[model samples]
Target: MARAPKDHKTNALRELDAAGIVHEALFFDADPAMTGVQIAQSQGEDVDAVFKTLVTEGKSGEHYVFLVPVACELDLKKASAAAGEKSVAMVRARDLLPLTGYVHGGCSPIGMKKRFATFVDETAQLFDEIYFSGGKVGCQVRMAPDDLALLVPFAYADLTA
Candidate 1:
């Protein structure tokens, strides 16, 4: 039997439920033209506490997912090192849906189409609860960093430049 994901209901939220973690979902306009920082600003959120999910493909053809604060940039060198890859580059935007089941501005580390090695920038450790896309546009999930770890096994690394 196929098992369903846990609480809050969106696939991403379901993921948290299945993982036995608790979190709240925040909905907002998921405008393609809006940067993560812009979305955070519209919600009156501290930009640093809102994170974006990035999809990258390693030199060897494996995909990796990274989460970093909305206002920060991912340092390729640091990401590559963290993933144990010689190099990794962002997957083309058009490829995201077919590859990760997410659109460019709405990717989430929790409910990707397939599990990939995931990393969260070390800065997220600074917050008791942080926000990230909820596997779709217009929604964000807020949860303690420790709870998030239960859904996506990730390491804390210097992913931001």
Candidate 2:
């Protein structure tokens, strides 16, 4: 029932609201150098329940999104397999903001400039709720994975290395 502060509504939060997805918005003191693990630690959340959003490009030039546990790395082979691409590569950092309307550490799977094929690490299903970036640094959203599916269509897969 923790809602975002009215003064700090992010695109992701707004999208969730429009979709009627229940969520809690968590804010913390954050530094640009902070990693996703550090952010989750600051929130006192288990690393397994917190995910980081990653963007990749397929050989066909299509973009895809993947949500992996903050403590894990995305296995490119698995990612490519899930994406049905022969290969996939991380999108260049410089292109993130323009392409997804999000910066590297602040990307969320919820709201992007455009919708792409999105996948979540199957481990996310192990939690009743999961935490992910709320569209910007210092903001995170806690919600049921099923609720998240209402906002973004995604499949669960073994995405970790």
Candidate 3:
């Protein structure tokens, strides 16, 4: 029998279950030293197909979630426009924990304390399947991009360069 994830009740997994989204959770020997790209590469996945959850603070002083490919960078201007804010800036790691109930690398787009407006990178639509943090290091959840869209009330936009 396989062992359960260290943080099994994470907002990410809970949201997926609540939405009835089908996904396969994959756990690997996590290396805290590795980046998301490194982790995906180690798992034999295309880096572009791996999505990273990033939290940004809008000019209005509210935080929003941006789901983009690991290999791409978040376009703050586009994200800001998508969120209907004047500007968007990356939130520091220390500030993220209290806001999302998860640490830096472990943050997931789902199950946030307050649902902020979210944006999914348009590039994500090109992939049939994408991998995202499973609310913890050493684990990831794979699901269809469309399914993820349903789970997150996010605007699909060209928010990545």
The best candidate in terms of lDDT: 2
Model 3 earns a TM-score of 0.91
- What stretches of model 1 exceed 4 Å from their correct place? 1-9
- How large is the C-alpha RMSD of every model relative to the true structure? 5.0, 2.0, 2.0
Candidate with the greatest TM-score versus the true structure = 2
Q: 1-161, model 1: which lDDT tens digit per residue? A: 11223332566877777777888778765667888889889988889999999999999999999999989999999999999999999999999999988888878898878999999999999999999988877788889987887878999999988
lDDT for each residue of candidate 3 in 1-161, tens digit (9 for 90 to 100): 13675656677888888878899777788778988888889889999989899999988898889999888889888898889999999999998888888788887787777787888888888888988888877668899988876867777888887
lDDT of each residue in 38-75, candidate 2, tens digit only:
77787679989999999999999999999999999999
TM-score of each: 0.91, 0.95, 0.91
Candidate 1 vs candidate 3: the lDDT winner is 1
C-alpha-based local distance difference test score of model 1: 0.87
* Candidate 3 wrongly placed segments (more than 4 Å): 1-3
Off by over 4 Å in 2: 1-7
Local distance difference test values of all predictions, in order: 0.87, 0.91, 0.84
